[model samples]
Target: MIEFRRNIVAGTAVLVVAAVSGCAPGTGDRAQPATTATGTSMVTSPTAVPGTLVYLDVAAGRPITMTTVTDGAARRTTFGTATRSDEHVLVPSPDATRLAAVESPDPDSVAPGDLVVISAGGARHTVATKVMWGGGSAPVWMPDGQHVIAAVGGQWRVIDVANGAATPYPAGPRPGADGGYLTWSTNGHWRAIGGSTDVTVTAADGTGEVKRSVASLPECREAAGCPTSVQAVSDDGRYVALGHMNSDPSRVTEAHLVLDMRTGGLVNLPPTAPGGSVDRVFFRPDGGMVVRTVTNDGRYTFVLLRADGSTLATLPDTTQQHPSGRNLVTYRP
Candidate 1:
C-alpha cells in the first residue's frame, strides 16, 4: 500500500528543443544554469525559508508548483506542459539549500534528459553526465546539500550536485521488487532491503543483521516473492518504511511494515479500510513520523506521530493551515 516513488516526485516537462552537454565537476563556484532555455520565469523572493514546501499540482494541463514559507507566505509558479505523474523529481535538501531535479530534452519524453541541481537562489546547474531513464525513486537530498542519492537502472548511486560524477553507495547489491523500488533513510548509517521473501537490514559495512520473511503475509501474493519492500528511511536511520506490493492486480492487502533498524522490531500497519489504504510513510524533518492514509471513504488523513509510535496530530487536510496554496508534505524522496 505504500506508493514508493517510481514517479511520485512531481514536476512539469521541460520543452527545450535541444540538448546540451553538461559542464565538468570542477565547474567553478558560480551557480551554473543547467538549461539556458529554462522555460520558468523568475520569481524573486527571499531565499526559500527553512520549512518551505515544494510540490507540483498535476491536476491542470501543466504542473503548477507552490512553494510555501513557514510564516504563511506562498509563491506559485506554473511550469510548461504537465508531465507524467510518475517521473522522478528533485527533493529539497534537509537544510532547504538545494534540490536535485531531472531535466528532460523534449517536452513529451518520458525519460529525463539529465540530472539538474537547483539552488534556493534560483540557480540551475545540470549534471549533464547523469542521464536518467526509468528512475527508480525520487532524488533524495543528503543531510548536506552537496550530494544526492538516487536509484537509476536498478542501482543506487550517490550523485554530486556540482559535478555529474556518481559514486557507488556503500550498500550492497540492489534488492528485488515487483515494481518501482526506492530505499528509505538514505542519510542514515543503517539501510534495509526488502525482497520478495524477507527483509534484510544492513550496516554501512554491508553486514546483514536482521532478516525476516514476508512471503506468507496476508498482504502478499505468490506471484510476487515478498510482499513488503523498503521505501523511506528516517534521518536517524533507525526506522524504515516497508511498502506492500499493491500495484499487482492480485489479492494482496495494501498494508505495509515499519521496521526498526536498531531493535529489529517490525510493525505491520494494516490498510485503513476497504477502499482506503496507507499512501506514504516517512519520518518528518524533526524525526517524528508521518503516516498519510486514505480512509475507507477516500479522504486523506495525515497522522503525525512521535518517534516512539505515539500519535501527535492528525490533519484531515493540511490545506486548513495554508488556505491559499497546496500543502504537500507526503510526496516521497
Candidate 2:
C-alpha cells in the first residue's frame, strides 16, 4: 500500500519544551551559586530540506493533487484527473521523465487494470494484464524503468515493459493473496511482500525462495494470531517497516524495524510519539535514510531516520482527514 498525506493546511505550529530540575549543592557560606539548567533542549522551526512534493488525496471532488514544499513555502499542482480508486500515485522517474500508475477502466472487468506509463513529453503507453487483479495497487518500477513489480490476482508478478508480459511468482498461503503490496530494494536484488500472514522476501529473478519470515522475528505473531497488514522494505533491503491492523481493519499500529536479511536479526525502533501508526516507509534518494510517518488524532508527522534506527529529523505536522485510510508516499531517487 502507498502512504499518502490526507489534509494540507496553510501552516501549523510545533511546540518544543525543555525540562529543568531544581537541586542544591552541599554546603556552606550562606548562599550557593545558582545552578544553570542543562541537558534537555528544544528547537523550534528546525530547517527542513526543500523540493519535496507530496501527492495528497483531498476531499474536494477531485482525483489526486500534488503538494510541493520548498523551504517553508508550499504550492499545489494539478496533474490531471487520477484514478478514483484508493491505489497509490506513482512518483515520476528521477529526471521526471516517466510516471507509472495503475489504471482501471471499470470495477469488474477481468483485465480492468493496466499500467499507464506517462512520459514528461506527453507520450503514453498502457500495459494491460490478465494475470493479476486489475484492481490491484500501483506498480513499482525497477531502477531501469524497463520492468515493474506489481501484485495482480493473489500473487506477485513482474512486468517486462518491453513486451507487456507478466510473470507471476509463487503464491503465498491464503486465498486472494494478491502480492499487490510490495517493496523493492534499491539494489534490485530483493523484494518484500506486504499484507501477508508472514513477511516474505524473494530474489528478483523469480527464484521463489523465502529469504525471511516475520513469524521468526521477536515480536511478530504466528499465522493464527497474525493480522493481515502491509509492510515497506528499505531501498537497501536492510529494514522492513510493518503495520499491524486491528481485526476490524479500522485501525492500524506500526513498528519500524531493521532486519539483517542475511541473518534475520531484528531491531525495534524507538517510539516516535505516544500514539499513532506508521503510514509507509520509503528510502531517500541517497539510500542513507528512510522516511516514515506517525499519525496522531487527525494530524500526520513525517520522520526521517538512519538505516540503523536513529532519528534524524521530525517534520512539522500536516493535517489529514482520515487516519485509518491508506495513503501513498513515494521518494524520488
Estimated TM-score for each candidate = 0.59, 0.59
- Candidate 2 lDDT, tens digit per residue, 1-333? 001100111231111111111111101122221244222111222356333434444332353454555444655555455544223334454333456665555533434366667653335577645334332244666666687766655455667766778876434322234333455554455556554445555545434334456665434454334432344454434345555532321123233544434345444443556676555555542323444555566566666553223565777544234553323344443
Backbone clashes in model 1 = 8
Model 1 Cα displacement at 135 (Å)? Answer: 6.2
Q: Rate the local accuracy (lDDT) of all candidates.
A: 0.47, 0.45
TM-score of 1: 0.59
